[model samples]
Target: MNAEVRVNAVFSDHMVLQREATIPVWGTGLDGMVVKLQFHGKQTEAVVANGCWRADLPAEKAGGPYELIIEAGNQLIVFRDVLIGDVWLAGGQSNMQWSLAQTDHAQAEIVDSHIPDFRFYDVPRVSYEDGIVHSPSWKVCTPEHAGAFSAVAYYFAKGIITELGIPIGIIGCNWGGTSIACWVSEQVLTHDDDLRIYADEYNEQIENFDWDVFAAKEAHYKEQIAEYDRRFAAGLREKELGDFPAAPMNPHYFLRPFGLYSTMLLTVVPFALKGVLFYQGESDAHRPLIYDKLLTAMISHWRTIWHHSMLPFLFVQLPAFGNGGNANGKEWPLLRESQLIVTEQVPYTGMVVALDCGDLEDIHPTNKKPVGERLALLALERVYEQPVESSGPVYKDYLIDHNKIILHFDHTGNGLEARGNQLIGFEIADETNEYVSAQAVIEGATVEVWSDQIVNPLAVRYGWANYTEANLVNSFGLPAGPFRTKREERQ
Candidate 1:
């Protein structure tokens, strides 16, 4: 370890370099120092300027247990057990950050999770750049280590490996209870009228930020959390424990707009990758209408940073959740609609529907396997050119025929069918915009809906609630996502 020479924190032993792509190895060193990198008998060099050095190794095929040796003056660094393979970045909030040990069938999955070629690199969660203490290294998938990996990422990698037999590396870059605003750059937030509110509000809060006041509040909040944990471990009821303490807002707060982009995402930029897998939107449910714009801008910003204009971006639509009542809440359905809009408008992007995999009372669904596997299916079909049905039936168009509203959909794999005894969760709206429950029947590749109470149906919506037993599915058994038709009221 030489003080004058250092490698970027992202590279380490057991790391997987993206195969068949130019491998970039960068570091900092004394000015004018010549840094050299050697891997698989291929050598490259760069001169350090402004205390930074970068060397690009020629592309190699997927297969390695090789040593990467770097030499700068007298100091030498060697990273061993490196593999060349496909690498993907898993980015989003809580559902994407959920751990394997917390998911369903965790015990069995952990026991069987011994894939030497599969690896993970969890980006350390830090609110600010200065808060980063140490460089987190990559880990090989094993029974002992797999429990801590992101369950969605683990299952996704497993699915890809089973299909391609190539080494897979997943970089977990996510946080729990985070908004889409937290991941995008500040410049992106400031430019858009609808998105500027997030940045403006954060700036207002931090303008008068006082370190002493924030520290005191944080200390108290920590104490309250410890007490709540102790009571829960002692079998105390949640009602007796009272509500969880809220953290004080500050410049370093994790939820602050652009905080994670500076701290978490920037650390792994320019690292070659296969693509990205995102699972988010729960936090943005309150303002669902603007999500399509926010997400599209964020995707473009990320691709710009990575210098890959067509990077594959696959995401999960928010699953059904009661949000503490009967599953018929409204905000989440709107957010899911926004997600669908992004997938339709953005190129090289896909969305996975999780309408049938939600909990009535719990927000974090434990069935992450389906979510992850669906993402893999999208990658297989769109990225790898494999023949796979990656999506469920998606709303395409509607035909108003007298009193009935007929709905047409794309990706109706084999055809649509109700998952239960009868089709449920359909509603029809009249010219006055008054909506009532309607009966729906599957007809060929389309669904026909009508209600005796409404003669002229102006609009129709299905699975339009926070949570619903929307039993509509394709022949592939994949559930159709929430959707609504746009129609104008008669004057």
Candidate 2:
């Protein structure tokens, strides 16, 4: 009598299941075996077919500490301290994975992080074709573990907890410096003409990779890391260590299409989720032209996989970085502009402007508190029907009159105001398409921009450069994101 029944490793003792959703509890059992699941005083059963079985538990409200029991003939499994609440998937690059210990005010935040309703599940960094090879189960949020947990996720969950008072589960599946291509499937890449190049390039790179050279590069990177640690120990902030050195190539691990997705995302599928908090785009800055398309494609594809076409996607727009001597010298600003396009064009999507939180020297900003809370504001307002402002002023429409261009914006929380005495970072261009510094002033919720040099202003740009210290913001103290009012034909 082989009556052994096993559930996915994700089904841990302290897991938080999505509230008000049909819970899909699946596992593998012997052929023709009947598996029964009991939770919240209800029982459901399923017959094993082809070595797999699933029981759909009825939807539950946002309250729990209930025990779940699974039985199959002589085999039985019990899970305690189960929670029913909002479960959010946190995904992206290094910024999304930036732990609390790495951020500002970490010591105080971590010391106070003793919320029992908050749970975390960090996916092991590994890529596989089949599924998650090593599953690290859910952990109860504590002061000790919170220090290593994703700062953005922790703060975001904290904000939601303060408002909703419900258990929150943040599942982190992020890889530092990974591109959006690494998260999507190969089929998604090959299906799109513009994105197919990434797949093709990875295929060629993998085929021609030299393991010996890669090993040498890895060794060199290790030495650099050691030196960096030594410098940090000598009372120097890690941010002062300057740019992180690029590591050796791992085509199959971080470069291949759907590499991280196949291993990290696939194993967690069919698990009900409230939404996704994404903070990527730094790695894709170089490909700014097609970023909006790629981002929309990723969101659409992810929704399809999750079987929730209306899944809410909240993302952080890239912030100001290194100096751009001129408008054309940097790719980051263009990427920021493209991010705005995705936020506006894509349905059920939100973008949090992080222009004010950027560090001029270091790419990873330490002020993750605002970024997290703003994302929570979006979810609270749009998803939970809470009355709150989730965004700064967003450019809506522009009207050109004589030499002046008046720009109108939305989400003006308590009207707009310049951070300093005078509005800055405004530029105007003529028919020649050469932008020059422009005088700008806030007139109600609209900004009037003009330049004496450009008699017939053809286009107007605000905070359009890579590292302009823009001062325009709403009353909420949230900085207005970058915007360019140039028509494609003019460029």
Instruction: Return the top candidate by TM-score.
Output: 1
For model 2, where is the 10-residue window of minimal lDDT?
321-330
Could you give the C-alpha RMSD of every candidate to the true structure, in order shown?
2.8, 3.3
The alpha-carbon deviation from the true structure for residue 82 of candidate 2, after best TM-score superposition, in angstroms, is 1.0
Candidate 1 residue-wise lDDT, 1-491, digit = tens: 34678888889999999998898888788999998889999999999999988888999999989999998888888999999999999999989999999999999999999999999999989887674358689999999899999999999999999999999999999998888899988889999988999998888878878899888988999999999889878867535655557677797789888989988898888899999999999888888888889999999999999999999999999998876554676788888988988988999998899888888766789999998998898899999999889878888899999899999998888899999899999999998887899999999789999999999899999998898998888888888998889722211
Best by lDDT: 1
lDDT, candidate 1, at 301 = 96
lDDT over C-alpha atoms for residue 63 of model 1: 94
Model 1 TM-score, 2 decimals: 0.94
Candidate 2 lDDT tens digits, 1-491: 23378887679899999999999999787889889999999999999999888899999999989999998897788999999999999999988999999999999988999999999998778765544356478888898689988999999999999999999999898988888999899999999999998898778766768888888978999999888777767857534654456665566556457788787787788888999999999888878888888899999999999899899999999877763233234577888888888977999998888887877756788989988988898899888989888778888899999999999998887789998899998889988888899999999899999988989988887777666688888888878898888635212
- Enumerate residue pairs that collide in model 2: none
After superposition, which runs of candidate 2 have C-alpha atoms over 4 Å from their true positions? 1-3, 129-135, 208-251, 323-328, 487-491
lDDT of each structure?
A: 0.89, 0.85
